[model samples]
Target: MVPIDTPTLGDRSYLAHDGSVALVVDPQRDIDRVLALADEAGVRIAHVFETHIHNDYLTGGLALAEATGAAYHVNAADEVSYARTPISDGDVVEVSPSLRVRAIATPGHTFTHLSYALESVSDDGIEAVGVFTGGSLLFGATGRPDLLGHEHTSDLVHHQFSSAHRLADELPEHTHVLPTHGFGSFCSAGSTGDTTASTIGAEKRQNPALTQDEEKWVADTLAGLDAYPAYYAHMAPGNSTGPSAPDLSTPESADKETLATRIASGEWVVDLRTRTAFAAGHVTGTLNFGVDGQFATYLGWIIPWGTPLTLLGESPEQVAEAQRELVRIGIDHLEGAATGSPQDWTDAPLGSFERAVFADLAQVRHHREVSVLDVRRTSEFDEAHISGAVNVPLHELLDRVDEVPSGEVWVHCAGGYRASIAASVLAARGVHVVAVDDSFDEGAKPSGLPIAAA
Candidate 1:
């Protein structure tokens, strides 16, 4: 077994093989890595299985199946447009003479979710070894059930409760629990303390969704759900119809004149430099989405779907890395890229923003007509924040920029990553941005700024 971890998305795909035959589960859109792993393992891929119509990232199941002549398996209930082996609850597939995988319908995150349990078959009969619990039962939490939208939240919460119990009841205590959506994934209702690997026995004892009272579990899960990226809306539909195979070829390189033309035409020009470097100097009108931060999530959230985008990075490597992140969420309309400093690329006057700490803001807030924009989530704002700060969650900033009062704007989130993103968005719109690029804890003190509950 090999676990292919995409750290940016906090998602995992697996290759389970018994000597000569292999089965892939929940693969991401980029199939090259899976293919490389299979080649190294000296096994031919025999099947590809999708847990559900993924709402977070594009799936490469159809493309991989076509490439390798493997049978692609998907839940019949999903009614996906692509041709696939329609798998249902309790369907067992024998991948090799010794390995058998059985499908378990575990719908909660989506209506068509399925979990596959791997078993070892021998003369002593089938012995279960592990299970791919895909968005149903996570390590220390259950998958959030509200991805289908507000109308289905309560109904899916009920289903999630039943599904968690079902997994705990049916699987052996020793069965290894491998999930696709818990390790820092936004699909989870809340943080799971960063746990990545566990067994059914441990989850039964530690997972709140498994141990808590059914009603209380559902209530807590529903209450803690946070807003996800806007790009998520396009993923399920794209996957349902079978997303086109990702084009991993390097994008065209844009010269200084080409980049200028694109920017003048109102296309998105993203700077993949460090936040500090971006704040020091950048091409005017370009938004800074640092390569080191959560680049894809924030970029996808703010950029309109199908908008032609071009990237400016320090090197070809940085641009390529950012491109990979962008394609994971199906943002494939990359027009081109340019690699150089602002001075090297263009003669336009460089733009910059003021970086400040919370304590510095405490002094400035009393004197100037400044507006503090809290870009954290609503829940974070409700806990404690600067008494007069306006709440505009980072994910919704592009749509609600008008709500942020004019004048010198100070933006911040729990950490500096979101604050940088918010600052860049505001800066791109010609708003004077002061990025509070430091820890929120240092700024939340009473001595630094007056604190109040939302």
Candidate 2:
């Protein structure tokens, strides 16, 4: 079994083979990576599986199956527009002489979710090896049930608990547990822990769905779920209709005047650079969504859907990388891109902002009137935050910008990443902003700032 991990989205795709023929599970929009992996393994992809209609990233399943002429396997009950070899619960497919796949109905993440049990066939007998739990069962937690919508959350959580127990009871104790979400993806109900490896036996001992009662498990899981990406609203619909392969081609090059015009017209001119570099200098009215951070997730969450996007990067490679990330969330094409220093992208004195650590924020508070802004989720702010800090999550910042108290606003999150994104948005909107570029626990809690519980 070979796992293809897309860390940015905190999801993993799997490829299992019998040395010659392989089956792929939950591939991302970029099929090239999976194709390259199969090529490197010297195996022909004979099947592609969708554990569920994904809500996080566009699936590359249809495109990959078409590309490889392989049988695409989706749940029989899934309302999809494309043709696929629909598999139902208890149905088993012989992928090759030595490999077999059995579908198990494990609806929770979605109403039609299925987990595939991989078995190795031999002259001795057929033995189950691993189960691809998809969004149903994760490493330590289960997938969040609220992604479908608030109306379905309660019913889904109950199903999620039952599905997890079903996997534990039916699968062998030693059977490896493979899942597609919960690495850092918001789809997870709770922490997934640091280990990448787990088995049914281990999960039974530690997983809440296994250890806790159904009522307790449901309550805890529901309580733990926070806000997920806003772009998730578009993913399942895009996947159900069968999205085509992503267009990763380089966009048209834009000069300084073009970038200026686009920004003036309210197009999203994003800077793909470090927060420090972006704070040092960047094109006026352009927002910073450093490519090295969770660039696509935050950018997709905050930007208006279908808005023209132009990327400004220090190098062509940076812009290219951003394009790939954006496509995973179904932002397929770019309006344009510009690469080079801020001076090269703009003739006017480039826009700039102040980036400070928590220590600086602590010292600055004593001297002047500054509105402290916490850009983390509501749950995070509720647990602990700087005393007197206004809570406006980064995802909701754009729409609730006026709620932020006026004056010099000092923005922060659990880490520096979200803070920088918020700072950029506020800066672009003419709010005096200072990004707190430090860990909240290591910085704010100990930096002489009065931390208070909401």
Candidate 3:
């Protein structure tokens, strides 16, 4: 237990194991929370570092560094299109006056991923106070090695094997391990274990990801890596180009004309409103996954990762929070957001789509003879689902389209994002898909819907 020194900087963190001073690891676009915490603690941010060129959160390290006059550090192996202080194996950096960070090159999660070691000198010897393993090692698991190209999968596995052992062998027995990702993050396997931070000795003993059989472990782990979204392809190129940080706290509102322009140009419309709120009235083709729906998780699933997203909500604050939420799930490349209602877009009688509720969906399934495909994870479908629904997890849907019946297809996830992605995949195959709008959360029965025990 790191004593909850990490206050989930609004889904990220600001503190290390000991809260005397703070080390901001992988700060997302809106760093106001971190800034405020540092201010409250009456301490300056000793150092700001990126674990690697994140495909998920738009890094605020550079911006935060500029604002606070802190030194920015990344992996020495990475040559991201910006001037950054590089850190390699056994490299230590001084933060402010007395604090120091030792960089341990832990590649495999990303080409440029490095874990920062806090050099706290004691009567015994110089040892790291805490290890900030950004996207490299999680409490229950480690980062996915296949995020990059498979060309280096072998090298990554080799490095990851060595990297885990390196941390296991070297990090102090009491040194705290703080990971960038927490629960609900697919970046690391077994993230749902709820083990936030653990001692080096504890991790070495328990974490299966850290055990010795390097080659086989790496091969097996990397083999099952899932495909990233199309949006990530776009955002990564830019993230690699240089330090691109968006002011997440200050998302600007777009007018109706601007919203219409983007929508007309065929950019996907993401309505960050509740299902009931969206069903009342919404622009046609706009997908609704409310801020309450693990906002970014749904965005990560449904919206193409790097697709130029334009947020629409009841207000500006809501949209800003939505953008930050999207960043948390690695969906960068945002366009802008509609602060107020762009009634003009809805007023027009152009191409539009509506929400598909349970009643409407039931009537359609009975009336039109459609193939209801449930795209939840196989385990979830095996648990329970709508009757006669085909089971195919969103990640595996594209490969197993044969299971998708020839008739009209209506897709759904625990919510809507997975459904949207499934629908998109089916649509590309020339099969039209209707996303069920009312299935907000898993096992939810809104008014009238039936499910069979699996």
Q: State which candidate has the highest lDDT.
A: 2
Steric clashes per prediction = 0, 0, 6
- Cα lDDT tens digits, model 3, 388-436, are 8888877666468798988677777776655654564565455766767
Colliding pairs, model 3: 9-12, 56-330, 231-305, 231-306, 232-306, 284-353
Q: Looking at candidate 1, what is the lDDT of residue 119?
A: 93
Between candidates 1 and 3, the lDDT winner: 1
**Candidate 1, residues 1-454: lDDT per residue as tens digits?**
7899987787899999997999999998889889999999999999999998998899989999999999999998887788999999999999998999999988888888999999999999998899998999898888899999899999899988888888889999999998988776788876777786898899899988888998898888888988888899999998999977788778898888988899889999999999899888888888888989778877887788888999999998999899888888998868999887988767778888988888888899778779899999999999898888999998888789899999889998987888887888788789999998888876558446888885
The digit string of per-residue lDDT tens for model 2 on 1-454 reads 9999888888999999988999999999899999999999999999999999999999999999999999999998999999999999999999998999999999889889999999999999998999999999888899999988899999999999999999999999899999999788888998998879899999999998899999888888888888888899999999999989999888999998899899899999999999999888777788999999888888988889999999999999999999999999999878899999999998998788899999998899889889999999999999999999999999999899989988888999998999988888888898988888999989887789999997
Highest TM-score against the true fold, candidate = 2
Superposed by TM-score, candidate 1 places the C-alpha of residue 207 at a distance from the truth, in angstroms, of 1.5
User: In terms of TM-score, how similar is model 1 to the real structure?
Assistant: 0.95
Candidate 1: 10-residue stretch with minimal lDDT: 439-448
TM-score ranking from best to worst?
2, 1, 3
Regions of model 3 farther than 4 Å from truth: 1-13, 16-22, 96-98, 123-125, 190-192, 244-265, 294-309, 325-345, 348-370, 377-410, 415-417, 420-454
Residue 182 displacement (Å), model 2: 0.7
lDDT of each: 0.88, 0.92, 0.65
Rank by lDDT (best first):
2, 1, 3
Model 2: CA > 4 A from native: none
